[model samples]
Target: NYFSKNPVTGKKVDWYTDFYYPLLNQWAERVRMVTSPDKLIFVEPVPNEFCPTSLAEHQPANMVFAPHWYDLNALFAKAFGDFTVNVQGLSRGMFPLKTFYWGHKGARENYTLQIRNIVEKAHDSLGERPVLLGECGVPMDMNKGEAFETGDFKWQARMMDALITALEQSLIGFTLWNYNPANDDERGDDWNGENFSWFSRGRALPPSLLYYEQDAPSLDNGGRILQSIVRPYAAKTAGIPIHFQYEMNTGTFTYTWVNSTPNPASQTYLKGEKSVFKPPRTGHPALMSLETELFLPSQLAHGRTVIVKGLDPGDKHRYDESRQTLFIVCQDASLDKVHSIVVSLDPPLAPAFAVNDFWGDFGGTITSILVAIAAIVTYFFLL
Candidate 1:
């Protein structure tokens, strides 16, 4: 039996019941006393644990369930393959036999299921409080540092894409593990041989630069797996966001949200009283004036077309190329109505060259060169 001496009562007590639980509650209470009540308190789960269900009894009003998740198989193996294990299930003693998933599609589905489970558990125990994925990222030094030697981070990009895609499918917010300027190819992050930093000082020539020479890294560049990291996302939504997905191969981004608001009497509405969208019956002009803003990366938005559906006739959309933002106003009279916006490349070419090449040229012909130059000039003029 787990036992501990209660410092306050000078008596022996059950470790988890009389000691650990009280200690955690007291610590949370103490933290709540000092910090502003309006500020969010991100309570981290115990290491290796999935959810903090123990705190359900004394959960603070501003408490947020923040948990860190990682693909243990990939993290430890330092190589991404077609197979993945159910590490979380094994940790929880759910099954004696470890579950395995095969193929890239299966692995990705497994990853997304893991995140979905975490979010669902938090919701079940915490009652609709925000669940923020505290940390999620892939190690850059995969395949025994193959990318470092060849400067081909395509594998790293794929791994990162898988991780982020899981997060996106779960419809949760996350903070990437790290961005360290001091990271290099040799020692990595300078801690326990761990190398997860997005940016690294060690310069390696990528395949794009193999044909050209450059003395310094471009101002827009520095990351290891940027193709997966630098992506389009909805910065702010006037209505409740339902779902969003980005196709890395096709340069297509789709976002959907419902034109609804929380009950006016709800705490969420009171917290953001000034910014909350009022119903049209309330005679609030801002009711139908709210606009959703989406951040579109230059590489994706340069020549893409924006299509918005389920919007009122007067409601419109605009693209600010300078800011790389797509703004859409949806004035649907029905609060239950859902609106969607899709941004896709104009030509809708094959994924292979459409996403990677700017001018969409594979041959080294003079005509291709001229087309590339004209595309560059047009891109600049639009900018």
Candidate 2:
């Protein structure tokens, strides 16, 4: 006799509306009673929704955002296609969200903006609480399982690239959707044929097609999706992240994060800064002795290809081809001051040219004397 849906506030009698909501409050209360200040309890708004404005207030003080992200195009279409591709599904016909959200902006562009917006929602609504991309990955069977048969995961790689670029640009952490050996292109994830697993011996191509492209014993088995997903990240970040990017064609990865602050909250929270007093040269949330582990396609970084500027004395770097990664360490860097770190695979070099180099080693003086004599002879003859 108590079933109801509010037309104004739109509250419903479902568990999510009543039981779960109260349960969350109860959990927060329990945390306040038992948990310490340092430990965190992560929470989400819903499957794909951003954290609501009230979420932060309702949770414990040490909670963080744990929103899930998915390339909506792939999720809706169940295929490796772009956002421009029309989304096809029953829910899409009655509701035009898929079409409208994906509107003319093309796949890569749309996803970047969309993912960025999602990240910003957490920042703006949640107030700098660390956001983790809880679950994200495109299904391998997209584009009608073309990659599985052709053994070319270019599509998967490109799609994953879009996803990774968005996450890194946002400087958020993510745990890819899954790592299920059971995902056959036929059975998928087994719950709803949702096969998003990145590793599978049954699906593994020959050693040649293996990610990292290394000869392996029976233990190691995964393909391009795994390769694309298991790339490098700042294992340790020195400061708040500003931005980072990866150039696909050049296989270049660039990362920037504020590692330190001479003053508190230099990177953000400016509204309250005027109230706080500080000393001069109390530079930004400053950073020094920054270190990053960068991934590359090949082993060694190209000659002089690793560059990190703005450190007090510049950064020290080394490349490991076996691991396909470059490790960089910087002693001093600043957020108020701009700094950059770049690692790339450069192109072949050009030959150097010098005006006198051609004859320098082969008797340059003799050649000059011969030239002078020829000039004198010509002058006399002409005269």
Candidate 3:
């Protein structure tokens, strides 16, 4: 009866009556016969007007209207809960063609709004069945340049955003549009002539860098190896030195000793397992004692510490670095220990040590004389 009046394949018949039911039957039958361990079928009613209009016009012969997707989700609990729902297909047309097929804003908006309206209808019809934007992407290659918005990368991003946004506000899963890479895929092309799919032997261009840069998922590389560390020296005290030790999980780090009090000589262990040490650099509290060192292979796997030592008064220190792993030792005036140790993989500084700053101060004869005199006095007195 239905076919005599409406030819199944004819352009005159509504696609929903002529094609939709046949396709739905095939899908349901396959799901039933495949009979895999975890395979099953759960059908629901979703209405859309723009597509063939068979289901849209008939209204499933039993269902009524309801709220949009987001409002339906609110029933589960506030804040649009998560869910997975199946979307049939675009109301009309195929992949690349669909993107450009609609000529006016009203048509495009109407199509998009139909999807939004269906989300609400489904929520109301089935009482919110885990809404997901099952499918709403397109396969774009280099050929259909005219079909795309100026064939520009930004257009792809915008299209993706629009398609994604059209789904339920609380959508969970989103399967991209038809992806058949074997059809002569071209990164910038629009069709199958040059591999119409995304995958290819050469570099595959994505919709756009801006899309991933803004919305793609990201991961943390374990928050840099080290956090923060400090080492202080005694101000007016007699022989008290300070040291520190840091515990870290990353591969590298920087060691620093903030020596407000001055020391004649302060030693930082270039390499050490545990305990204390004293070296030759000294400065005030604000001045820091720093050492940037890489961990030996044996020491890299687990945890370790570095020691800082105050050979004599007048030593201020701090240290830092941006490496995979590090162990630092600085003398602490507060502790009786000879040195302090911090283990990490953080950078000691931002600008890093410039050659000009590291060696520029070693000026002339006056500097040499001062160093020599200071060395002599420190050796005689501290010894």
Candidate 4:
């Protein structure tokens, strides 16, 4: 066993400590000197970037954990088919990915467990600091976009559900892998065939589809893929999330949390309303709300509302369609009263993912066109 001399103890420590701890301290000293106090410096250890121990002195006061994850099995298959997807005999044997061990329930458990361990490590290493899943998501060309081409994205949807459930269970925030609407299939991200982008142009938007020509339909132009992967989540919270699950098969969403702070939390947003599932409703919903974006009538999908529990009946909650998030605002906003919540999605499609080093380029042209239409309507009304 290799060891190093402890800085203070004058005793021996594991070999990794000599490098990892100093790296963190050096990172902190450099980041802290240049970075604004308001902004944080997320540190990753040598090699894998997984933090194994609490960063010693010089770690920024607001440092966070940002790590990316990928399932080796899915990467090997170049598809999203996991334990939930069925693969039968003869055809299955042609590839090692379909082998019993890799495609079994145990494999899924291992995936979930790995998430748990990451969260566990962060908590132990950082003293009650925040954890953000820096990057996660799977490639799109899996099975040659079979589910996507058919408009039945349940396979990828199921995988996303498992991923979001794990994050919710761990109470961690995440950013998905990519969203290059212009992602070319042959040269994914212009590097290799690792097309984990949520939005890609593998297939054109069919007339039956809802999007326009310029619109980057999700994961090979599959609406369900976008719908499933980009649903409501608690953006800012009054407390730590304990459990959250959205069942696509049943269209149910449930979230629970324990209040950790006494001060009222700022507003919470449930983004992606323009495209997400909107429960059956008649009148223009997004137009009626201040938080929601005023989308072009054609661009606007019906907005969804949730049944709430544990919240004061008087508190204001709305699904802001424009921003693509759900908002929970309370007059009290006190942690004492709003510690826990349950949001039941009317026709939930379970859970959500990512990509894109940048999110600004994608165009929401419908929004621009809607603005023009609204102006025309106003002018006609005046005339």
Which candidate wins on TM-score? 1
CA RMSD of all predictions: 14.4, 15.2, 28.1, 19.5
> Model 2 segments beyond 4 Å from truth?
1-19, 27-39, 83-105, 205-220, 265-314, 320-325, 333-335, 346-383
lDDT of 2 by residue, 206-257 (tens): 6566456362333355544544565556665555446677655444566665
Q: Tell me the number of clashing residue pairs for each predicted model.
A: 0, 12, 81, 19
CA lDDT of each prediction against the hidden true structure: 0.69, 0.59, 0.33, 0.52
> What is the Cα-based lDDT of residue 361 in candidate 3?
39
- lDDT per residue for candidate 3 within 1-383, as digits (tens), equals 55445545444654455565666556656665666423443333342232222444433322333222221111122211112111223334435333332212222233355465554444443432334444444333322443234423322322333343343122223444444433322343344332223323233334343234322222111111111111111222223222322122232322233333354355443423211223223333432333323332322332333333433354343332222223333334352234333333233222211212212433576689999999999999998
Per-prediction TM-score? 0.73, 0.67, 0.29, 0.59
- Candidate 4: residue 133 Cα off by (Å): 1.4
Which window of 10 residues has the lowest lDDT sum in candidate 2?
Answer: 349-358
Q: Kindly provide the TM-score of model 3 when superposed on the true structure, using C-alpha atoms.
A: 0.29
Q: Evaluate residue 43 in candidate 2 and report its C-alpha lDDT on the 0 to 100 scale.
A: 72
Model 3 ranges off by over 4 Å? 1-30, 33-38, 42-114, 130-132, 139-152, 168-172, 178-200, 204-383
lDDT of 4 at 287: 22
Candidates 3 and 4: which is better by lDDT?
A: 4
lDDT of 1 by residue, 299-377 (tens): 5555656555555688888888678788887666464567777777665523521222212333457677889999999
Question: What's model 2's TM-score?
Answer: 0.67
TM-score order of candidates, top first: 1, 2, 4, 3
